[model samples]
Target chain A: ARPRVGYFYSGKKPGQDISETMNNMKVGDFQSIPVVVREDVSVYDAISQMFLDDVGTLFVVDKKSFLTGVLSRKDLLRTSLGNQDLSTIPVHIIMTRMPNVTFCFKNEPLIQAAHRLINQQIDALPVVIEQPEGLKVIGRLTKTNITRAFLSLSESHEL
Target chain B: ARPRVGYFYSGKKPGQDISETMNNMKVGDFQSIPVVVREDVSVYDAISQMFLDDVGTLFVVDKKSFLTGVLSRKDLLRTSLGNQDLSTIPVHIIMTRMPNVTFCFKNEPLIQAAHRLINQQIDALPVVIEQPEGLKVIGRLTKTNITRAFLSLSESHEL
Candidate 1:
């Protein structure tokens, strides 16, 4: 069966345009440098990068910092507890590879990005822009960013 | 400032006993083996254990498996990204020590545990039982557990 889409906001009025509502906000406004790790980095090093960056997800990049893949805490955890050595395992081995990643451009609506996060049940999104070579991951949008936006809206609406 | 509590359910009716709504549930019913790590274990090994467990939060246990503290991905990440060696750092050095942890008993109403998680913006709680020696980490309650219950309730309510 096709996975559910926009299931997170099923309570929205049937005629409403979620994308339209989200259009008022722009992805560029919320983007921040993503927690990143190299493809060759050990799973051990990747986990360290996550903790130091205070992020649950890390965007894997190439030597040129091109978007390569994504790895999350669960990925590192799975690779760590096994009988194998964590230092021997590279993060790229477990990352959700590129092209398969759901990403948003700098000007995309924040809500659209959030929808991808919710629908996929993933934590964050890599905000990228097309460069001559490929997609260079510029920043990220996370569920937390959406929540902050929601809170900001609610607070202002109450006023 | 004292952190906010019950803000997650501030919409709750003024006269309502939130616990009353949670009577049908028990922490034991929602508890699972929290991803765990030993206090003395290297931060590197701890990250490995997390991936193996498929859990976001890791309950720290002592030699006797008694609850000592909690380690989150953030904790490990904070310790990892710097020049400090993750392999040499023990988990306890970064764990949120006991008495500072937000937790609940197996018999506490599930709503109460859920409330603590939401109010504090924490990921999981170690379910414990008090013993003469100390608190024995029996199981865990996580946001995913609460989300599961919420989905179940919504489905039933619709029916």
Candidate 2:
């Protein structure tokens, strides 16, 4: 029997332009939309939000809506156990701050995005849009979402 | 039926120990081993090696094994389209150099690793282990592998 051809490379409408492949993909195509929280928010509130959202990570942003830091579930737990009052303490105090925090643009290819995650040994990344001043927080890319996209793509290829 | 417990809270084993928890976790685990070709290797030879290894990405390293640059299948294809004499062209001419490339350490947390991949917008990451002089490449983490790990963890949680 002949090997099966992947659906991704299969025939498309005659008018479809192949060079525009990336355009068809969206930011949501490979990233998990992380639950974001403001820097001033209490650690207690952030934990609750994470539990409710069923996500392992959260993006910490500033008043200007720019990404400031990231807070992982482990980080929150570690800080909470260290005698810090979750309710009284703001997320900014414990977050992995900027310069230390890494991010990606929303328009980038999924393959490129995945490479960054594995190379950096990071679980979650803030998705931003390039602005004249800098970058604006728009979404998030998580390990969970990347896995989902990979599986979906692989399955499509198998078919 | 009881609600499915998530991986974070699922009690597979007893007695919570932070050190043990960290040790058992495998976020920085690499699925693929990275292979590098020297600057003197012809692009044709590099492409052949990539195919023989069935890898999508290749690192171009120097004699010291220090990562100098990277080459991807897409990059090769584009380069081939412009030059037919790729057999004589060294890979260094078309590779994306070190300063422009992103990478990760073996000790980084999974959340951080995932975040970096998404942020950098790349597909494969070179896993490095710190040595006396500098970092040495140990393994490679790919989107496919991350997806597999995530799905497996999620499935285990569901079970």
Candidate 3:
């Protein structure tokens, strides 16, 4: 008889029990540095920051550090080429606004995270902690992080 | 003056050219590994193989090594828990069929690859190459690989 995937009865199970499991999981386990910009920043500055940061996506936040929108490389390029004055405009003008942006919780399971990435069709999702009024952006969950976790999990089981 | 988000070239550039620009930019880069299993193997056996190999997903192939379906951990678990007789059943019954699976070409840019992951909501995609008459599965691209690429790209840009 071959070995089976042991039931994770102790720690976490996918679906309905995620919230409880999330509380148990450490935030550092899957955290990734987020690329962020201020709302008042110029589009050129945002683009330059993205290039400097080497990230395809950038999170737009207000002075309070609250997430307001997202500026992707594609979004920047399209907006920049569409306008006549590249240096005079602000990133918030062309950014994809809140409520439209998809995000995930910081303590989410890798499996659930994978599902979010697939279902949303976005490369990266901001990892946030829920507040009474809204969400607080903390880290990021990317397709790469999920893949690495999967690989590591698989390898550990093998060993 | 604030940097502008738009207005780089305030003229009507052809949509095709923008599409080309999007295609040219590399989104993520990483290597993929290929693993195959026969249909006659028990789900238990297959799971063990997956565990031993440190892969979350496995490609179910036929005697000719042609791609058939995919068996992921979640798929296996969902199927097994639903029926107690999974130990006797072959893996092919619950595996996702090839037509339903999304894949990528070797030369396709990372951006396109990332899009596939986002749209498909799958953690891993089998990388294939065009053959004379059909497509051949070469490697797999996963979220982990993409994340690694993103981080490295960021590091390189900083240097």
| CA-lDDT, candidates in order | 0.68, 0.64, 0.62
Candidate 3 stretches greater than 4 Å from native: A1-159, B1-29, B132-134
Error of 2 at B53 (Å): 0.4
Tens digit of lDDT per residue, candidate 2, span B88-140?
Answer: 78999899887787777777765456556766666677887766765577777
Model 3 chain B: weakest 10-residue lDDT segment is: B10-19
lDDT of 2 by residue, A6-101 (tens): 233212111122112223444557766667899999877887787678666788877787777899765664554344456788989999998788
Residue-by-residue lDDT tens digits, candidate 1, A63-154: 99889899976666555545466778888888999888888888886656765675676777899888988788888886556545543332
For model 1 the local lDDT of residue B46 reads 82
Query: Best by DockQ, which number?
Result: 1
Best by TM-score: 1
Question: Which residue runs does candidate 2 get wrong by more than 4 Å?
Answer: A1-145, A148-159, B1-24
| Residue range B1-159, candidate 3, lDDT tens digits | 342233233222111222222344343246557777887887777777766776667888777677778876556544433424555879988899878878777677765677577566676778776667555678877666665543333233221
lDDT tens digits by residue: candidate 1, B13-125: 12222122335577887678766678899988888776666567889888998889998866765555444667888888889998898889988867667767757778788
| Weakest 10 consecutive residues of candidate 2 chain B by summed lDDT | B10-19
